[model samples]
Target: MNRLSLVAVAAAVFALPALPAAAQSNEITIGISISTTGPAAALGVPERNALDFVPKEIAGVPLKVIVLDDGGDPTNATTNARRFVTESKADVILGSSTTPPTIAVSNVASEAGIPHLALAPFPLTPERAKWSVVLPQPVPIMGKVIYEHMKAHNVKTVGYIGYSDSYGDLWFNDFKKQAEPMALTLVDEERFARPDTSVAGQVLKLVAANPDAVLVGASGTAAALPQTSLRDRGYKGLIYQTHGAASMDFIRIAGPAAEGVIMASGPVMNPEGQADSALTKKPGLALDTAYEAKYGPNTRSQFAGHSYDAFEVLKRVIPVALKTAKPGTPEFREAIRQAFMSEHEIAATQGVYNWTEKDRSGLDDRSRILLTVKNGKYVPAM
Candidate 1:
C-alpha cells in the first residue's frame, strides 16, 4: 500500500470529532513532551519557548503547561506520556516535534481519552483515534504545493532525494503522488542516512537524468550532504530543497553553491525589509524576529513558525474551553475542539487558520514562504 495515499485517505476519514457531554471546571492542565535535549534538540527548544508563551486565560481562568523531555527517543516519549497523564493529571497533551515520539505518545493519549494537540507533521492515524489533534502542516499538502510551483514554471523532470526513515518516506511518497497529477516526472530518487558525508553519487545519478530541478528532504547535519554533492558535481539545474534543507547549515556547508537555490518553507523570519507584506506588519512579527536573534541566525526553520502556531492555537482555545466546560472533564476537551473548529477565519502570525474535517492544518499556499540563499543569507525568492 502507498503510505502517502493511505495518509491522505485516513486524514480525511478521521477529520470528524466526537463531541463530549457537559462541563467540569477548575484549572486546566496540559502536558507538553518535546525533544529539549538531543540531536533534534534545536527543533524543540524554540517550540518550547513558543508553548511557554501561551497564556492561562481566555475567560480569566488559569491554564498550565507541564513539560517533559523525551530526549528525541520513542521509548522515552511513551514513558513521559504515561507519566504526564497519570502524575500530572493533564487534560490535554501537546508536542513531540519529531514523528517517532509523537506517534508513541499519541497512542497513550488516545487510550487514555486525553485530547492531544500535536505539532508533528506525520499523517494522522486511527491509533490517534478520537483524542488527537494535528497542528503542523501535513506533508501531503506540501507536495501538492511544490508540484504546483514546478508545473507553473514548466518544470517536468525532477530529482528526488531524502532521509531513509518513516518521515522521509512519508514526504517522498506524497511528492510523487502530487507530481503525477501535475504531469511532473520523477527522474531520480535517492536516500541517505544520518551523519552521511557523501551523496555525490546520488547527485551524479540524478544529473545523468538531466532533471530540471532537485528536491532535498532532510534536516540537521544530514542536510549538508546533498548540497555539497550538487556543488561537487557542478549540476546547474534549479534546486528546490524542502523546508528541512533551508537551514543556515546548508549555506555554511555548500558555501557559494548554495546561492540562488529555491525552496518551499514556512515563515522563518519576517520579510520586513524585503517586500513589506502583511505578516511583516503583524503585531507578533517581533516574536519571530526576537527568536532569530536569541537563537542565533542558524536556528531558523518552518518548524519554528509551525510550533509557534501550535501554541497559538492552544492559547486561543484554552479560555473558551475553560468558560464553557469544566477542566479535566470530557466536556472541556470538546469545548476546546469546538472552539478550534469554530474559528471561522483565524488571523495568525503564520497565516490564516481555517481548518475543517477535510484539512486539519490551516496553512495553505499563502502560508508558505519561497526562500533563496544569497551569499550565505536567506532572503525571500520572488
Candidate 2:
C-alpha cells in the first residue's frame, strides 16, 4: 500500500528510518517505541529485532509498522508516541522496554484512544489500564514465585538493590508485599540510576546487612551491576533477580557472579526446558530458534518474546476486528481493543494471555518459570 513499511532511525524489516512515514489513510499502521539504546538496550534491541520476523501482512491486509528509539527515557518515549499518533496516525502502539517509559507511552496511547500493547510491567492506573494490555508477566506474579522459592529454600531475610525508578519501585513493593506476610525481614534497600557505572556503594550496604538472599530489581545489562558488585564484596547470600533480568546479557556481563543467581522468568527463557504439553512451548521454541538463527546461539531475550507475542495477539484479533470496522479508522482501533478483551486463553510465545478492559497483564501462573545461571547458561532452577 505504501512504499515504506517503517519509519525510524534504523533499518527495518520493511522500511528504512530515513524515509518519511506513510501519509495518513493507513491500511493498518503499528508504531513501536522501544529502548534500542541506553540502559535497556539488552531488552529493546532484541524486541526491535524480533519485529523483523513479523509477517509482511496479517489477515489479508498490508500492515505498516513504524519503530522509534526512546533510549529508555520517559520523555523520549512520549515524544516517540506523539510522532506515531500525529505523523503515522498509528491505529495501535507498542513499546518502551522499561516500566517508566512504557507507562509514558501508554499514557500517550490512552489519550489518542489507541490500543497499546505494553512491553514492560508498568503500574496499572485506571485510565491507562483501560487502553493498555501489557505483554510481560506482572511483577506481583513473578515476585510471588520468587518469594515462594525463597521460603522453600529457607530464606528468612532479604536485601534489595535496584534502579532508582518506577520499575525498581514496582519490584520492591512486590518484595515487601510477599515478605511482610511471610515474616521475611527486609534487611536493606538501595537504589541506583540506570546510567550509573558503579553500584559499589549500594552493594556495600546490602553486603553489610547480609540477608539470606538479595533481590536485584533492575533490568537489561544494568541489572548485572548489583550482582557483580555484591559478589565482589564477598556477599555469600543467594541472589534473586526479577524477570527483567531474564536475558543472556546478564550472564555475559555478570560472568561468574551470574552463577547460582536465580530469576523468575517466562517460559520463553528456556523453551526447550518447558513441558511439551504447555501451550507456550511451541511458540516459545519457534521464536527462540528464529532469533538464534538470525542473531546466534543463546541470544533470545524474554523482551523479544514479548514483542513476538504482541504480534501473535494482533494475528488473533485483527481478523475479528476487521469484521467490525476497516483498518486506519478509530472505529477499527476500538474494535481491536474490544476484540482483545473478548479473546481469552491466548497462547503466545511468552505466556497464555487473557486481558480484559479492567486488567493490564493477562498472564497466569503458567507464564512463570524459574531459571538460574549454571555453567554460564540458564537452566531450570527446579
Best by TM-score: 2
The C-alpha stretches of model 2 lying farther than 4 A from their native spots are: 1-4, 9-26
Report the C-alpha lDDT of model 1 over 125-155, residue by residue, as the tens digit.
Answer: 7557456666655676556666777777788
Q: How many pairs collide in each candidate, listed in order?
A: 5, 1
Candidate 2: tens digits of C-alpha lDDT, residues 1-382: 5332655653222211332333435378899999988888999999988887777678878888888988888888888887777767788899979999998999888888889999998987898987899999999889998988999999999999988899889988887787769978898999999999998888888888889999999998988999899999999889999999999998999999999998989999888887889999989988999999999998989999988899999999998999988877778888999988898889998899998767768888999999998899999996
Whole-model Cα lDDT of every candidate shown, in order: 0.67, 0.87
Error of 1 at 221 (Å): 4.3
Cα deviation at 295, candidate 2, in Å, is 0.7
The true-versus-predicted C-alpha distance at residue 236 of model 2, in Å, is: 1.0
